[model samples]
Target: MTNYKINMGRGFKATTLLLVMSACILLSGCAGKAQTGTQGNAPAPGKGSAATNQNNTGGQPEQQKKAVSETEGLPSGVKVQKVLKDISLKNNYHKKVELLTDGGKRITITDPNGGLVLLNLEYEGTILEVSGRKVTVQLDHGGQQTMTIPDNMTIEDDDNLGLNKGVEIEWTVDADGNIQNVELDD
Candidate 1:
């Protein structure tokens, strides 16, 4: 009977020790302390010092704005103060037709019809050719080209002002300085 009691005591002690050790470990993990390998969340190497300065000053960081393309001039009566990206098109009911981008901003333009149009603007816009439903534009980079108005798609000008939903168009100067072949939608 003595031996049995001794064994029970040993088991109880072991269980108690385990529970205490577990609690200590959990409590240690919750303690707050600066971690190694980083200095108070400082900016890493290669990032400009401007970011850190802005954070330290508690002021908003200055954003670098993109310049407007010379080729993509504003229309005669319509002034385009800023070029936007990520334009969207949807039906009158607000159903999403597509997402447009000037390569960055998401623009959404609703059409009178139940169709949505999304425009993705490039850095520099150049009208190369509008063959059938395919409209190709010259990219800013030399020899590179971007095409809009995918094949097997029907495009109708809602405003009849040259810009059509789901169609890509660009203005070009001709010998007579007149806008020609402006509509390219496939």
Candidate 2:
């Protein structure tokens, strides 16, 4: 008659959960820092203005900062020249960068991706397979790339590899995705 017993489901221990939460909180402050360029000299606190007269402890009035024009080094009253546009990079697939030139004039720059430009690229991977002038390479970061070799694309197989070989390839491709040069590193 005393065979009846109680059964309860298992639950997480509070001590273990607390440790994980504490670790996450402590590690959250280890994020990368931002990159800031050179900073200008800041005026001391309590200074009214650059032209305000303030006596130092040595009894000398503070010097006022001189105002210089943007074209200080150039001829007087001459307009300063600046870039009108940038095409080294692209903000989007079809977006062209706009820049301000001299006299506050705006100019537009065409993206290099939209036109033909010579680009040299290098990749180190294992040659998984090779078919005629086409080669498939397996990258070190778990990926593969198939390269098409054109008649004008130079190929220098220093490694003398056929298949399944660690190879480094240097190639140049045009903006139209056409291979123009290929060099295999030893």
Candidate 3:
């Protein structure tokens, strides 16, 4: 009889310990998940985190969305301006106009408020013929162009980069379609 009582006490203690352990595990598992409150204002379905527009029902604050812009990171009072082909810049000069000729016609940027400006443009072709200061080139897409090589034009490559037939080249042009500079394309 004494052995039976001893065994029963031990079994009871083991059962109590198991129940406590199970309760602790269940509580710990539930603690990791977020819980929504039922008191205050909640957002509508598919709108935000909480339920329908019930305030005070709380969880976390809604995160603000970031705005996107193409002209982001540009200096204040600066803007990008695009110029079309065959447009003259003689009458549209800006105080801080910067020209970039990287394959299309030259572009001009003007700050209506007289601020800084940047213009991007380009043209590329293969040398077809070179006659004195005049060089004829076959446009990259599908056209023929004749540009006058300037006296001080810099060749941005080694001596092997000659204006010969089949040689690809990139150049910046002025408002009058004159070649301002040339670079050999590898």
Candidate 4:
């Protein structure tokens, strides 16, 4: 009878030890997997990482200068008298860009996803004449050019740039010759 009792105690101890060992192994494996899963969701490499990969500090500034100059190129017959904004692909992101030669033109281009991307081309000019949808403007660089106003263009005359002709104004545009926005220079 005593021997049977001793055997029962040993069996219970062995089973308990085995269960504890199994549980420990399973928990460790789950913890390792959880740590690895978090890495997959980490944010993408930031701008600093890109710079580090270049291996040369001088190279970074050269790349930035090139980017700014790439967009600074002006089309034929277009002159930037007062640079309102230095636009580049690194700065502007829009479907179409308009370069306004006249003031008192109000057009707003917005991105619903927020203003993460900026597209602004502004120049100062004087209104030469307003004839229906077309307005002739004397550019700062001593040339007169006419721009057609879209019927859907919004006018915000807070500065009264659009009140009459012969007003000095600031305007914004896109890559194409379509006006995006306009306002008083002051």
Candidate 5:
């Protein structure tokens, strides 16, 4: 009986040691694969070129600029002429309103219920549009309002304006110089 007990103890120790060694080997293999950087050898989704891969890895790429909305781009060269508030149009009426850009060229606004709004420079304040993160404003006269600008919108030091930050417009302007009534384009 004593010999049998000793054998059992030896067998248990051998099994435990084998399990421990197997676990260590498995963990080491995983670490090696990670170090090699060849887990799948396939590029991750949305990670194509080196630049895109850097962006995917939460690393900013060289020569790549951060994207800014169109309204933010407007207030730089342009200046705000006036701020139209309590604008009682037929449809929407905004609370805190601001007209931005040099000739009131661009409109940056925040409404009570509505979200962020942006007007264009070329078009007079007649054309108003709403874009929370993005927007498309159609002028009451003619043309389309786009919230996409390639470069970063910058504001230089020039006091030909009243409002400092951005403003929120309550109403949307149509292409015909009328308040925006129709639903936004998808």
Candidate 6:
């Protein structure tokens, strides 16, 4: 094996030059990608890394369906992979789905239709209050959100499938955070 050494003894001028060069290279690459993807160039992402591989695969759904199946406890026939939770909606209830890639860095999906891959997420929360089919959960983002409970459900402790305060609930949800299926965690 060969030994490599980074010169930590470099002066401020060298460091500054290195930083400027890096900035230029990154900016140039970003400009190229932005030009290809956008009309006016407001700095949106170009082709996504995760979906481009599966979505553009000769117009096939088998590989996409297979990938969506890996997500645990998703609803049948629901092709979304993750659903973001929020206290309110943007663009009139239009929500965003995020996927973890590139060493756990999250990339916001630029594609509206990600083929069979989607953002059907499962949220884990503590039940703050419950009444009928309505439930309020203390979300992972440090706020409470109210959602409607699905009819066909299984509750771990409550055989009646009725939600109660202080219980932990894991729910399969859509991009809007609406509960599609739910079960008790404890």
Ordered by lDDT, highest first, the candidates read 6, 4, 3, 2, 5, 1
The lDDT per prediction is 0.33, 0.37, 0.45, 0.45, 0.35, 0.45
The TM-score measured for candidate 3 stands at 0.38
Question: RMSDs, each prediction?
Answer: 27.8, 24.3, 30.7, 28.5, 29.3, 19.0
lDDT value, residue 3 of candidate 3: 12
* 1-186 per-residue lDDT for model 1 (tens digits): 011011223444576588668845643443222224356564443242476455545221111111222222322332233443322221111211111222212222323221222222223344465454444565433333344443332323333323223334443322232332233323
| Alpha-carbon deviation at 167 in model 4, angstroms | 1.6
Question: For candidate 6, lDDT tens digit of each residue in 1-186?
Answer: 212121223353466478678856754665566557647533223233445546565332223333333333333433333443322122111233433221111112211223331354556678787777688888654456677756554333333334667767666655454554466655
Residue 86 in candidate 6, Cα distance off native in Å:
20
Runs in model 2 with CA error above 4 Å? 1-122, 158-164
List ranges where model 4 is wrong by over 4 Å: 1-57, 68-73, 76-119, 159-163, 184-186
List candidate 1 stretches off by more than 4 Å.
Answer: 1-55, 62-124, 139-144, 151-186
Best model number under TM-score: 4
Q: How many residue pairs in model 6 have overlapping backbones?
A: 8
Error of 5 at 114 (Å): 4.4
Please, what are the lDDT tens digits per residue for candidate 5 over residues 147-178? 43222322111222211123221233422333
Candidate 3 Cα misplacement greater than 4 A, ranges? 1-103, 108-116, 176-178
Rank list by TM-score:
4, 3, 6, 2, 1, 5
**Better candidate by TM-score, 1 or 4:** 4
Q: What is the lDDT of residue 20 in candidate 4?
A: 69
lDDT of 3 at 68: 13
- Comparison by TM-score, 4 against 5, better one: 4
Candidate 6: global Cα-lDDT?
Answer: 0.45
Across 1-186, the per-residue lDDT of candidate 2 in tens digits comes to 111111111222254366568744533432111113222442343333344434333211112111222332232333334533333332211212212121222222222123211122234456666666677877543456787667443354444432234555555433244554455554
Clashes of 2: 0
